[model samples]
Target: MTVAPADDVTGEYLALRTGAGVVADRFEAVWIRGADTTPFLQATLTQDMSGLAAGEITRAFLLTSKGKVRALLWVLVGANEVILLCDKGRQADVLRALVLLNVNMDVTIDAVLGPVIEVIGPTAATVVGSLGYDVQAPHRWAFSEAGHCVAAIGHIRVDLPRFVLIGPSSDVVRNSGGVFVGDLAADAVRIEAGEPQAGRDVDDATLVHEVGALDGAVSFTKGCYLGQEMVERIDARGRVNRRIVGVVVGTNVIPPHGCEVVQGSAVRGRVTSTAESLYLRAPIVLAMVRREVVDGSAVTLTWDGGSAPGTVHELPLDTFASIS
Candidate 1:
């Protein structure tokens, strides 16, 4: 992971929150092509992919039959094919999962080699619009004359809309308008939003609801999918032992990832991601905390030699309400 300087990161973070910032090559795009594309994905992924019109996108989870997350992806419905967007380096896992689930279906999965551009901020639409792509609302998408796919994506925070442009990175950056930033800015925002990354914040061992990803990524009303039974059972029961939550540290120090979150002597959770937030002027992190530790609960994060005091916050902290 590459990081910008602290000052540069702060500027970039502000650009993403107040205006717009473009990040290239931060995500991966995999193309699932063939006539059976929708049905194949609909049968495997947790979300309903059927009846998705062209220029629409939905976030979904590819899970095992036992309901453990295999991949967290955004399914972009195209006329002839479906584009799956996921964290960089997790494409191979997603491809393999789709391959195993193919059965006798007529579908071909291939990695799309191109620059993936992420446009973040409130004016993200305006920036992408200048590039001749009209991504009307969050979850809607459009394509460009030069073969770029532009999808307006929903963010954890309501005010900051995101747009993903998959095509030529250089061309997208040169032609589009926004402050260009690196991974650090994105990490800060993602941590603050309590968004879980596939391999980092979550893994094959984790369940969808355990990370608070069920609402957008899992569909109860949809037809049977790979993990439907486990999902439905859990939904009926109505809770997971642990869930993703925000932890605002009392000081400015960013705790290293994988630290134990303790409520007194009891181990409550583990820190998944952390960043020094410019907006909050403190260290913020995403952690998979035990259910008993609700928002506003005070907790101590401990590692080998250091510990920090923090307060648990629900996902998508309320600090963004002014802009939201």
Candidate 2:
């Protein structure tokens, strides 16, 4: 709600890159418990969840039988329960799907409903450190005596060293003393970082193969999980019809959501998300283009009346070192 101003977003983005910034709120968590919780989730997720240590987190996805995505989830392992992190209100859908399989499993699904404050940028470590918790590695989480758990992890839109302070509220709000960046500013950094977001860049029909960067999301070695058959089959067949890629817009024009990316008169792709990049000083976008769209290929992003010339670039559009 009123996270940042449009004109000031660029400035806030720059600050997030060089120093520290906090997003006081934006995420929610769902609680999955009862003795069978671990095996229940492990059987349904793309990531292996059976061996998570205390205060650890991992990325995963819940998919349909046809291999389409239902949700992108960040699973946090605590002592007595598991926390599933996702975009606000996404837990309800996840819970609903999960309840169908609860026939014999001793599991209870509930929402954590916490305020998730994100501390990000190169200085993320410093900011959280001052708050009496150490988040040294990505996926590593630690909780303070006050019940606040901070996990070093990226959001749906992965950028730099990002960490989330999650609880009933955030100590970072009172202790970190960092500058606050709103959703607008945080979003610009996301596009610049080239991470596709769930519910925005991805949808119910979107498959996991379309999203770039599976560093920690999927486990090919794991046993059967929901939608695993399709995942394995896709790998064996070697490629999906379309994959998400980045495009550097040639003009100042921002591609509206769902705008078509055309190759001559043929529509080859659709723009899913866009942002004005201060680093590039131009608009950049995430588009699901046909796998045939070769790297460095030139394309046109067509909106209502006009089109902007753009070049297809691989994901991770902006270099991490460049921002520093």
Candidate 3:
């Protein structure tokens, strides 16, 4: 099916919820191959990479020495090499960081300038299945006859399974009976799922624990890695000053990024992402708010001259699976 235009955000949004939407160029891949690839990654990433068998994938974080997030990655371990997939426009950063950390290790990092297609929504599995690949369990991947790597990445909505097909051909999605969606819809689903985007929902200054998706990306039992000390320190404290939270505005107006979220006179947080949620029929945002702003708290979002009344809620927004 033809992809929806920018104005038709709801068209693409609904397509993904009801069927499938193919999102391309949402991610970039880096191929790392060498005798020391596994050990190199195990020492650099927040996730434990030791004993990661072939055909498995895991979400991991590459952090600065201070425990700030550098890039969120999905490491796909193949027979001879491991592929690191990160948000679009981040391959260079990850590559450079790895190179600096190589030191005496022997590894070759090359950017894979291939087509990255994300098949998302409820029927995403069916679309991939029709293409002759078994719907691999979450965090598992299989190579297609055409050499395209099909990885069953986790979901945005619990019912909406997401798959990433990374390889040379964009034709994999053709005639697959899936709707093509624009970036807006895909981003909305991500916000609704409480998944953070690299430069948008998170950045170099953001800590790994401040985001809600930590349980999957972090390995508390793993050996030391870059930024491990801060992670352990914060884990011991069991709290952070601020965290990424969701704000729902009961109106059509969408707040711009950086709009201040206020409770009375205090500026509690700033909105990092905004979307007109079709599920709630209102505008929603992902914001890094002070920890005291608990769920179900009433708040107001204010910008230069415009303000909208909203309420704070935990990430994923509770109404994700109840689309009507």
Give TM per candidate.
Answer: 0.93, 0.91, 0.94
lDDT of 3 by residue, 1-324 (tens): 355665787888987777888888989988989888888888999988887899998889999989999998988997668998899888899988888888787788899888898888778888888777768888799887877888998753354578998874656567787778887788788778877888888899898888766766789997989999999999899998989999999667999999999998999889999987777777899999999899999999999989999988887874446532
Please report the candidate that would top TM-score against the real structure: 3
lDDT (Cα, tens digit) per residue for candidate 1, span 1-324: 123356698778887888778877768878988889888888888887876798888888888889898888888888868899998888988888888888888888999888888888877878878777766687887777777888887664455688888885655466466877877788888877666788888888888888774666777888889988888888899988988888999976789999999998999999998888888888988898789998898999899999999999988864455555
Error of 2 at 237 (Å): 0.7
Q: Which stretches of candidate 3 lie over 4 Å from their true place?
A: 132-134, 156-159, 318-324
> Which of 1 and 3 is the better model by lDDT?
3
lDDT, candidate 2, 131-168, per-residue tens: 77765577777777888777887654444788887773
Off by over 4 Å in 1: 1-7
Off by over 4 Å in 2: 1-6, 155-159, 168-175
Candidate 3 accuracy as lDDT: 0.84
- Candidate-wise lDDT, in order: 0.81, 0.78, 0.84
Question: Per model, how many backbone clashes are there?
Answer: 0, 1, 0
TM-score: which is higher, 2 or 3? 3
Worst 10 residues of 2 by lDDT: 1-10
